[model samples]
Target chain A: MTTRRSVLMGTALAAVSGLALSAGLAPATAAEKELNIGFVGVTSGPAAAWGTSNVRSMQVRADWLNELGGVKIGDDTYKINIVTFDDQKDPKRAIAGMEKMAQEGIHYVVGPNVDDGAAAVRPVAESKGIIYFPYAFPKELYTKPASNAVLGMIANYQSAPAIYKYLKENKGVKKVAFIAANESDPLSQRDGGVAAAKALGLEVVAQNDTYPNDTRDFTPVLTPIIRLKPDLLVLSGVSPGNAPLLIRAARELGYTGLISTETAHDAAVLKEGAGELADGFISVGGASTPAIRSKTMDEFIARYTKKFGEYNDESNTKVYALDYIIETLKANPKAINDVAEFKKTVDTFGAPNPYVKEGTLKYVGTTSFGQKRQLSVPMVVTQYKDGAFETLFVGEVD
Target chain B: MEQVIANGLYLGAQYALIALGLTLIFALMNVLNFAHGQMYVLGGFVTYTIYGQLGLPFVLALACSALTLAIVGALVEKFLFRPVIKRSAREESTMLLAAAIAFLMDAIILILFGEKQRGVPKIINGVFVSDSLVMPYDRILVGVIAIAMIASFMAYMQYSRTGRAMRALAQDRVAAQLMGVNVDRYSMIGFALGALLAGVVGGLLVTITGVNSGIGGPISIKAFLMVMIGGAGVVGGAIAGGFILGMMESVGLNVLREFGDVTYLVIFVLLMVFLSLRPNGLMGKPWG
Candidate 1:
């Protein structure tokens, strides 16, 4: 029973079984070469849903591409391997994650999802020639002299003006109030939204209502904000988790004003947290609603839910980042390592968006960052009703 | 102003529930349990599973959460803390262990519960509106439950034999041992009680703000602030600290609404100044 031949056979069988078990976890075969794409972001902590969505979407896409016999770049076909790093929402760890990605020779990265992490990894991404698509909204990150960082989705400043103008024009909204978490991301977004509100000539009734991230009770916070009695209340850059709480608090306090956020929100979460109270709550609800979702989008949602056992609506926008990376690399194979080449193709590069039937994949942000440094995520603002999102209006990023 | 007081009282009731468990453990063992927040989170998640997922009654879910956390606390005290304490007399060792435990619990929480913010259906419907004062019925129920729990805990600690033994141990561990009090059993019980209190608060609060793995650390930090303000290891002081922090937050947020989000910073500064004057806190004496 303990013979060397038997043990060797057992080991061989075990190795084969292990490989078979890890079918979707890694590239299924050694026949195909691998192209490593890095994801460095907070996969844990309070802002987890955002980064988690980013990672899951990329992984599903990578697996899908690999299943389709890999992506072609220049003359070679390489299996897309997503390398993930959980920075735990710490900027220092995000830097370390970027360094680790660089050491692995991965040139394209998906995220450093928050403002601090996005800023922290800038030195590493630039120095290492890593073209990172960060889901962060710092203007400095996407502006000139910051060539490598691309805005992964529509930022608050970009989304707010579109949302505010629509509401003002449609709902006759005159007064706007802004509230934010004391954190940098929310504070920045709040300030950006305030500027946008002022630019639209909407009267700023309340501007500096902020609370700590860990605050559970919002009655005290919102009472003062509600007293201003603006026609609209905006929670700037609120995390997906905190949005419902703020909404619920505001609504329960009998403030009949319309409430909105420029950040992503989960309809299911809103329903569960605020119930029927969250009806008419507006937020950036990604690029598609059930009404506008294409076949490809439906398939992606089904497969993602099957694989990960859950799907966040935020992932609808997140899938675009990796798709952009792979498509850009195919356009200019040299950009696999050099971000400058990627930049050169940004204005000219165009492809059919896989998520939508009639949508074209292109770069935007000419108006926001003075360059095509943002993905043209169809700015779909939505209102939460029951456990689903109803598309309010779809605007294009300038 | 009425709204501020109402908010404070509501906030204070919940905060007191959280601080009770933390202060109780600190009183008996002087272990500044960094993992206390994780325990509370664990409780919330457990309740969520039972109530939100399994469709169990809310009362049953709360009870299960309490039971689960008590067992967890007892095991932690018996295996981790007791072993570490017997092996080493250093306070830093226990502190390190607690931090390690917090990280470990966070990891476990991530693995068991995905990073999604989990919430339950509103236990009750309707709103209570009287002039400028607006409060939800669910919130009122939670506040009442929290106050009831605190009162029950106080009564138990006063009337119960186990409570008296725990008090004796907290007063003087060595002296309690010499007086034929079973130190190890009582210590374990105290730790369990502390963890149970945390669980109860977590379970109750999950109905309101929801629970995520990420909130544990912050919850613990908040609990620490309450303990510091009220005086560490002082149960009454912990309750007092909770109410004080709650009142300050309520008043500060409204009064200084025009001053941006500087309420917490101002409170922190004021607290620091207060601590400098009375190092033992308002009601605490050293480890009180």
Candidate 2:
């Protein structure tokens, strides 16, 4: 009995020592805490703009955070070191990139805005317990809780509903028509539009779906929509890639109606391709400029212009917002430990959405699960005018 | 509907100009010249460099890019395609390889120039408005230039000695060599002319579509589709195919809501339909 008791004690001691060793070697306890962050994007492809913009935004945010002395974790200053991987818009490549990042000890990642890359990276993020923030608006992300680590800044699939609300209540819009590609994931987002319109006492005049992202000429679908004479012309799933041509086609066909899109935030090329035709088009999403109030936005735009020679866009704001989150998390000593605890802090943490870099940011809630934010309000509608976007509606801070 | 048809026609002519070059190369050498789109983009870039930076005349920029592309084409045919033809086992693989090279070159362009679209100002400025239908004078100018280019191409092929040699080579390269044609020289010339055509078309495209490094792949794909659908073996077939596809795509989308993806689908369907029914394309002469 004595021998057995001693053996049990010895086993307990061994287990305790092993636990102590692991605790000592873990990533959190180091003097200068180093965090590896992975960024997955299409560093090359036709839609490379999406990736490049996001990368630049993240870089700017990181630089700003480090300037303010990195993410503070307890007593240690943890410097965020981002390692980016270019997925080239392929799902297989995106998966490989995520796996490689996970293998390389990346516990946190900012992601691909494109649908294919977003879908591929989500599973890997969940499997590895890596925090993945994607810029895409695929419904599967919100419908199926992949992981607590997986979160989107915006609820992408539900924008049409929000847009429909603004149109009906604010603009007195009664009739609407929809156009989008049938095969694309974003096209499914338009499905909510008809229901939303009907709920708001608006008639759905017509609906037409296209095949690919690059379909430019819109006469066939436009003729019917124009004939229907809907007050609001809704392009629910028009990507920046297709915006130029579709807008141009509509303009060419004498469409002088109020054309609105929820996905119009990133379509910068519309200014060049459609010129004046792109004017008066309003898109519901993050504020472009002037509308968003944040000093961080001003700094971002200045630095982005200095570095990239362009104004800040959605990708820029999102990454900047994330940087603020990371920095705020680091500042709170309670968030430095396990992943679940870190997420709870994130869900509850409220800092100014200093992402706009240009104006004042006021955040409102801890409801991160339902796209509720303590920092940002509903997306403001911005109209394209004189080669720049001007804010039309300021979102209410709830 | 008439307006849509007219618009499609104008767009179709542009496609035809680019497609004709691809068709010419395919007919003579049985190579698609996947880098045709890059050559077109390079033409625009070259023009931008000349007219915008160097302050040269617009016409000179257009001429210089065309001439330079023509020379480059000869060099490419001599170096890249000629060696491969000698050991031609996988023709499709070679085409795909060329496409990969084009992709690499496009990346180089993006890295160098950055991905912003730059416009070259129109040489002529005027508008033709017909009772609410307004067409830019540049469009009219581009259409005229396209017609002139087609006429010159046809005339050269029909009348010139070198053109006849290209025709003979197209008929049967081995047979042409047997008939005292220096096949290598003729092939080089054909490639050069094809490149020259691409350069000019590229220049013309910028007048409407603006120039960006990333436009090559999509443009190349469109050109390829046009050549395949309209026919691939003859110069006329390429032009006809280009115009048909271009117009169809431009106006088809306006007519059909799902027209964007349909354009690509229609091309493949036409290709399959044509292969089973009329294998040589709509205008391609039968090769034996």
At residue A250, candidate 1 shows an lDDT of: 91
The superposed Cα distance between candidate 2 and the true structure at residue A60, in angstroms, equals 2.8
Q: Model 2 chain A, poorest ten-residue lDDT window?
A: A365-374
Q: Please give the lDDT score at residue A246 for candidate 1.
A: 89
- Runs off by more than 4 Å, candidate 1: A1-31, B286-288
Q: For model 1, how does the per-residue alpha-carbon lDDT over B1-288 read when each residue is reduced to its tens digit? A: 899999999999899889999999999998999999999999999989999989999999999999999999999999999999889968799999999999999989988988888889889988999876889999999999999888988888888998888988999999999999998899999999899888888999999988988999999999999999999988898999999999999999989988888998999999999999988787874232
In Å, residue A223's CA in model 2 sits off its true spot by: 5.2
lDDT of 2 by residue, A149-238 (tens): 343344433455666777678778888877776554456556666667777778887765454543333544454456566788877756
Expressed as tens digits, the lDDT of each residue in A1-398 for candidate 1 is 49999999999999999988788566656557789999999898888888999999999988988888889999999999999999988999999999999999988888988999999999999998888999889888988988888889988888899999999999999999999998889999999999999999999999888989878778889998888889999998888888888888998998998999988877777877788889999999555697677888999998899998878888878989889998988999988777789889998999988786568889988888988889888888998888889999988886
DockQ of 1: 0.74
Candidate 1, residue A149: the lDDT equals 88
